[model samples]
Target chain A: MRYFFKTIHLIDYKNIVPKTVIGLFIILILLIPVFTRNVVTLSTLIMTGIWAVAAMGFTLVLRTGQFSLGQSAFMALGGYASAILTAQMGLPFWPSFLVSGLVSGLIALLVGMVVLRVGGIYFSIITLALGEIVRIIALQWEPLTRGSRGIIASAPPPIILGGHELVNFNASLAPYFYFMICLVAVTGLVFWRIGESRLGRTFAGTALNPVLAEHQGIYLMKYRVIAFTVAGVFTGYAGALYTHFLQVITPMVFGLWQSIQIMIMSIVGGIGSLVGGPIVGSILLYNLGEYLSRLDTPGLQSFLFGSVVVIVVMFLPQGAGLVNLWERFWNKVVWREEEYEPDEPED
Target chain B: MPPAEILIEGLTQSCIYMTMAFGMVLVFSILGILNWTHGQLFMLGAFIVFYSTTAAGIPFPIGILLAGLVMAGIGILIKKFIIDRIKGELYIGVATLALIFALEGAASLLFTSDDRGLAIILPGVLNLGVVAISYQKMAVIIFTLIVMTAMYFVLNHTKVGLAIRAVAQQPVAASLYGISTERLSLIVMGIGCALAAMAGAIMAPLYPINPFIGRTPMIMALLAIVIGGLGSLTGAIVGGLILGFLHSVIAYYISYLSEVVLFGLIILILLVRPQGLFGASAK
Candidate 1:
C-alpha cells in the first residue's frame, strides 16, 4: 500500500505543487466573495495578506542569514510616513507609497550599517531597542504623529485593476484583500528570484559560514546591507497594507510586543521559509487567538502559542515538521537516492 | 524641585536601576546570553508580592521575601529545564520567547493585564529641608542598596560566587576543576532572579503593577549591562547609574524626549565601545 502511494507521489511530484497551491488559494479567494458581505471576514483576510507580505520580506533577510525583530518598526515607519504624506501633505497615493518604501529603505540602510555587525540574539536585542526608539519618537513627536491619541481616517491606496480604478481601496475590505493578494504573489516571486541570485548565494554562504564567505570574497557587509534594504522595501509594503487594513495609525501599532509577535510568526513559519508568514506562526496563531477570544478571554491564547513554540523547538526544530517529515518518509518509501539533498541552485 | 529632592530622587532611581542591572549582568556572566525574560522575572516578582500581601494575607516583609524565593525557583527551573537543552542563541531566543508568552499568559489569566498598586512596606513621608521623601520609597532605596552590596560581597569574596565566576570566565576550565558548571548556572540564575524579584517587590507600590511592567526596567538594565559590556557585573552597576541619571535628568527637563535622548547616549556609547564601557566578555 505504501509502495503504491510512493510510486504515485514520485511520478506526480512536479504536478502536485501547483495543484495544491491552486486548491488552497481558490478556497481562500472563493471565500472572499462569499465572505465579502461580512466586514469581519474581509478584514481578517486583508490583514492576513498584509502580514504574509511583510513576513516574506523578513524571510528574505533570513535567507542570507539575517534576522529582524524590527519589522513592525519599519512597518510603522512606512505606515506613518505615507499616511502623513498622502493625508496631511495631500500627495498622490502612489508617490506616498513609494515614499513610504523609500523612507523604510533609507532607515534600514542607516540602521543596518551598525546592526549588521551583530548576529543571533544580539541582532534581536538591537532591533528591539531600535523598534522601541521608533515607537518613542512616534509617540513624543505629537506635532507630527499626534502622540498616543492615534491618528484616524488616513485614506487608503487607489487601486487600478484591469484599468478599472477604485479611489478608496479601504472603502471595502474585499478590494484591499485582493490588492494584498497581488502583493503576496509579487513579493514571493521577488524573494524566490533573489534567493536564487548570486547575491543570495553570497548571503547564504555568509550565513552558513561568515568567515569562509569572507575568505571567498563574498563581501559580507555589502550583502548584509542589501538584505536589510530589501527587507525594508517589502516591510514597507506590508506597513502600507497594514495601515489601510487598520484604518488608523498610532505609536501603539508598532510596539516591541508587536515586533516580537511578527518575529514569532516568521520563526514559527520556519526560518527562510517563504510565505510561511501567514501559515505557520503568528498569523495562524493570531487568527486562532482572535477566534478563541469570541468564546473566552484571550489569556489561554498566548499559552497555546508558547506551547506551539516549545513543541516546535523540541520535536520539529526544522519547520511545521509535518511536510518535512512526510517528505522524508516519502523518500524512503520511494528509495530515491537523488532526494538526499538538492545541491542545485534553488529554483 | 529643590536641589535636595532632586538629588534624593536621582539617587533612589539610580539604586533601583542598578539592582536590576546587577541581576542582568549576573546572567550574562554565567549563561552568556542576555536572557530577554529577565524583565518578565522582575514583573513576576512584583505580581507575586502583590498576591502574597493582598490575596494571601501576608505581611509586607514576609510577602516580599516569599515572592523572591518563589520567583527564584521559577528562574532555576527555566535555566535547568528550558534553557539547558537549547543550543545556539537563536534557539535559546525562541525558547525564552515561548517562556515570555507563557508567563504573560499566566499573568493575564491569574492577575489581569491592568496595573494594580501594592501596599507600601512603610507609608508616610520624611521631610528634610527642601526634600520631602516618602518613607516607603526610602525603604525601597535602602533595601536595594543592601541587596546590591550583599551581591557585590558574595561575588567578590564567597566560595560559591567564586566558583560561579570561574565558570563564567571559562566553562571548560571550571568543569575540569570539578565545578559542575551546569549546577553553577542554576545557582547563578537563582541569585539573579532573586535579586530581580526583590526589586519588583520593593517597587510594587511605586509603579502601577502589570504583567508587562517588566519591559521598562529590563530595557534600562539592558542599557546598563550593554553599556557596561555584556558580561561585566561591575559595568552593569556603573551603566545603571549612568542610565538612571540620564533618565532622571532628562525626564526632569526634556520630559517627552527623555527616552530618545537616553537611547541616543547608548548608541553613542556602543559606537565608541562595542564591548561595553567595562569591556567584559562571556569567555
Candidate 2:
C-alpha cells in the first residue's frame, strides 16, 4: 500500500487541470440560484460564503501564530460602519463597503500595535477582552447602535453596473447570492496570491519560528500586525455583507459565539491549509449545525460540533478536512501496485 | 452605596474569584494550557449541587461535597483522555474550547436552560447597627477562607503537595527524582476542577444557576489571574480581591457599563505591565 502511494505521489499532476476543475466548481456554485430558487438554500449558501471569507481572514492571522479571539469586534465594526454610512449618512453601498473594510483594518492595525507586543496567551486573552468590550460598547452606546434593540431596516446593498442601478439586493436572493460568490472568489484569489508571495512565506516563517524569522531579518511585530490587519479587512467585508443581506444589525449578532464559530470553522477546515480548508469547514459545519438544530435537539448542534473538534484535535492533529486521508485510502485499496523506479538502488 | 456594604459585597465576590483563580493558576502552572472549560466546570458544579440538593434530597453541604468529588473525577478523566493527547499551545487551547462547548451542551441537555437556585444554606441576617450582613454571605466568605487555608496547608505540609510543586517547578527533574509527573498532572487537574466546583456549588444559592452563568465568573477569574500573574498563587488571590472590589464598586457606580470599564482597565494594565501586576517577566 505504501509503495503504491509512493508511486502515485511520484506522478505529480502539475498542470492547469486542477485550476480548471476549481473554476468549474465555482461556476456551478454561481449557477445554483438559477437551478433552484429556494430562499433557504440561497440564504445558507450566502452565509457560508460570507463566513468562508471571514474564516480566510482568521487563517491569515493564524499564519502569524496569533490566536485572535476578537475577530468579531472587527466584524461588528465593519457591519456597523457600513450600516451607519448607508442607512444614516445616505452613502452608496460601494463606498460604505470600502470604508467598512478600511475602518476595520485601521482599527486592527492600531489594536495590533499594542496587543501584538504582548504575544502568546496574553494576546489571546487581550483579544477576547477586546471582543467583549466591543460587544459591551455596542450594547451601551444606545444613541449610536440603539443598544440591544439593534439597527432595524438597515439599507440593503444596491447592485450597480456602469453607473446604472441594476438591482436592489432586498428584492431577490439571486443578485445577493451571485455577489457573495464573487466576493468569496475574489477573497480566495487574493488569499491564494498572498500565500504564494514572499509576504506569505514570511507569515509562515513567523508562525513556525518567530525567533528564527527574527534572526533572518524579518520583523515579527510588523508581519504579525500586517496579518492581523488583513484578517480584519476580510472579516469586516464579510460582516458588512452579512448586515446588508440580513437587513438588520445587532450587537448580539457579533458576540463571542460568532467568533468561536468562525474559529471552529477554521480549525475544522484545517487551519494549516489557508484557503480550501476554512471554506470547506465553514460550509460543512454551518450546514451541520443548522441541520442538527432542526432536529429539535436543544443543544445537540453544539454538542456534536464540540465532539467533532475534540475528536479531530485528539486523533487528527492536522485537522480532518486538511489531511488527504482519502488519497491514502484510495492508494491502499484501489491502486495496489508496486512502486515505479526509473533507476533501482544497488542496496 | 455605603462603603461598608460595598466592602462586604466585594469581599464575598472575591471569595469566588479567588477560588476560581487559584484553580486556574494551579492547572496552568502544571499543564501550561488555559483550560477554557474551567468556567463550564464551575457551571457543572452549580448544576450538580442544585440537582443533588433539590432533586435527590441530599443536604446542601453533602450536595456541595458530592459536586466537588464528581467534578474532580471529571477533571481526572479529561486530563487522562482529552488534554493529555493534545499537543502544542494552540491545539490544546482549541481542544479545551471544544470541551467548554461540549460541557455546556451536556449541561443544557441535562438541566435544561432554565435558571435555578438552591435554598440558602445559611438563612437570616445579622443587624450590625447601620450595616446589616446576611448569614448566607457570611457563610460564603467563611467557606472561602476555610478552603483557602486548607489548600495552603495541603500545599505546604503534604507530601503530595511537595510532589505537585516539584513537578510544577521542574517536571523533567521531578520525574527523574522518582515523582510521577503524569500522576501529578492528574492530581492537579482534579484539584483544580474540584476547586472550581466548590466555588460554583457555594455560589449557587447566591446567584441564579444556569448553564451559561459560569461564563462571566470565568471571564472575571481569567482577568483576576491575568492581573495577579499567570502562575503565581499569591497573585491569583490578590488579583481576585482587586477584581472583586472593582466589580462591586464599579457596578455600584456605573451600573451596566461596568463590564466595559473593567475590560478597558485590563487593556490599560496590559499596556502598562504585560507581565501582569504580580507576574514575573515572560521567559
Candidate 3:
C-alpha cells in the first residue's frame, strides 16, 4: 500500500500547469491570423520566429562554452544550398530544406574536427576567419552564386496532401506566419528537452572546465562537436526557411551584421534560459530595431542596440531572460520573508 | 605589375598593418581582451585628420598629431568608463563589440556615410631602373620606420615602457612592486589608440576614408597578430609583412579572390600551428 502511494505521488501532474500555459500561448499565436490581417505585423512576427530559431542555435553552442562567430557562414551555406537546389536543380522545397540542413551539419562536423582543437578565444577567431572566408567565396563564385546579383526563386513550394495542393506559402503572409510559429515552437521544444537531458548536463560540465570534464572521463571534443553540429542544424533550417520565405537569397544577407544580431539576441535573452531567453530576445530586439527605424534616425537603432548590449553585459551578465525575473516575482509573492531570511546569514 | 613594384606596394601595406597590429598586441597583452573597436578608432583617426586638414585648415603633420592626441583621449575615456567595469573574456568581447557598433554609428552620423579622401602631400614619383615609385609611398614607408624605431626605443629604454612590460608579464608582481595596474592599463590603452590613429592618419592620403574602411585593415591586423603569434611584437611585424606580400601578389595574380586565399591560409596556419608561428603555446 505504501509503495503504491509513493508511485502515485511520483506520477503527479505537477508539470501540467506550465504545459497548459504554453499550449494556450501557442493557440493564441495560431489565432493571430484570424484576428489581424496586417502584412507588416505578420512579416515582423515571421522574422522574429526565424531569428529565434537561429538564436537558440547560438545558445546551444554557448552552452558548450564556445563563442562561435561563424553562424552567418552556416546560415549562408544553408541558404545557398536550398536556393540552388530549388531554383537551379528543380528539387522540391521539403527535400532541399532537409538536405541544406544536413549539408550545414556536415560542414560543421568537418570544421569542428579541426577548429574545436583550440578552445576559447582562438576558437572564436578561427570562426570569424571562417565566416569571412565563406563570405568572400560567396562573393567571388559568380557562376554558382551569381555574385552580388543573388538568386531569386520563383515561389515557395506548395504543400500537397493526397495529390491535392493544400497550402501555397508564397501567396499570403498568414500561412507563412503559421509555418514559422510551428517551426519556432518545435525548435523550442527540442532545445528545452536537450537542456533538461543528461547530455545537457555533460555539456555544462565540459563548458565549466574542460580539464575537470576530462578528469571525469568526458570526451570534451566529442561533446563540443555534437553541440556545434546541432547548432549548425537548427541555424541551417532557419536559413533554408528564410530563403524560401524571401524567394530571393544573397551572400550579403548572412554577413557579420546578421551574425552579430543573432549573438546579441542570445545574450540579451539571457544565455542561461534556453527556450524563453532566445525567443524573448529575438522578439524584443527585432521589434526594437523596427521601432527605432520608424523614428527617422538613420543609425539610432544600431547605436541603441550596441548600447543595450554593453549595459546588459555589465549589469545582467546572465542575460535579460524573463524566467529568472518571473521566478523572483513568484517567490516574492509566495515567500518573501523566507527569501529575505537567507540574506541575514550572509550579513 | 613588375615584381619590384609589387614588392614596394607590399612593403607599404605591411607598414600600415604592422602599426595597427602593434597596438592590438599591446592591448591584448595587458587587458586580455580583443578590442573589436580598434579598427573603428583607426577610422576615427583618419576622419580627424580629414577634418583638421580640410575644415580647420591645419597642415598634414599637425593634423596627424591632432588625430593622435584626440584618439588617445577617447581611448582613456573608454578604458575608464566601459572596459574597466567589464570583467571576464566573454563580457569584454560583448562590450567591445558594442563599442564598435556605437562608434560606427556615430561615425556614420557625424561624417556622413560617404567616402572622403585627402590630397597627397607629396605628389612626385621617383623613377628607378624597372619601377617608378611614388613619393607618397616613400613618405609612408619612411614615416612607418621612424615610428617603429621610436616605439622600440620607448618599449626598451623608457621607465613607463618597463612598467607596461612588467604589468603585461606579471600583473600581481608588478603591482606589488609599486606599479598600479589600473593606471598602467589606462596608459597602455591610450598608447595603443594613439598608434592606431597615427596609422590611420598616415594612410588616409593613400586610400579613401569611410566609416566602414577600418574593417579590412582591422582584419589584416588580426591576421598578422595571429600569424606572428598572439602576444609577441616581433611576430606581429613578421606576420604583417608576410600577409602584405601575399595580399599584393595574390591580388595581382587572381584579382578579387585574394581575400579567399588569405583567410584560407590563416585557417591552414591555425590548424597546423595553433600557437602561431612565433608565439609561445598558450596556457
What TM-score would each prediction reach against the true structure?
Answer: 0.88, 0.92, 0.93
Tell me how many clashing residue pairs each candidate has.
1, 0, 1
- Computed on alpha carbons, the lDDT of every model, listed in order, comes to 0.73, 0.82, 0.81
By TM-score, is 1 or 3 better? Answer: 3
What docking grade applies to model 3? acceptable
Model 2 lDDT at residue A345: 14
- Model 3, stretches more than 4 Å misplaced? A1-19, A162-165, A295-297, A317-330, A333-347
Q: What are the per-model C-alpha RMSD values against the true structure?
A: 5.5, 4.8, 6.0
State how far residue B280 of model 1 sits from its true place (Å). Answer: 3.9
- Model 3 chain A: weakest 10-residue lDDT segment is A1-10
> By DockQ, who's the top model here?
2
Q: Compared with the true structure, what per-residue lDDT tens digits does model 2 show for residues A1-347?
A: 01111111111122212678667986887788889889999999999899899888888888787887888888899998888888777887788888998999999999999889978767878888888988888889988888898876354557679999898776779988987987888888888888768888778777666776789999999999999998898888988989888888988899777888888788667664577778877988788777777866676667777887788778753323442343334455656544322232111
Writing each residue's lDDT as its tens digit, candidate 3 over A1-347 gives 01111110111112323578767977898999889989999989998899999999988888888888888788888888899898888888778888998999899999998888876667877888888878888888888888888998656667889999898776688888987887787888888888768887777767766777799899988998999998898888888878878888887898877887888787667666677778878988888877777866656667777787777677752323443444445557754633321121100
**What's model 3's lDDT at B65?**
87
Give one digit per residue, the lDDT tens place, for model 1 in B233-256: 778888888887778887888888
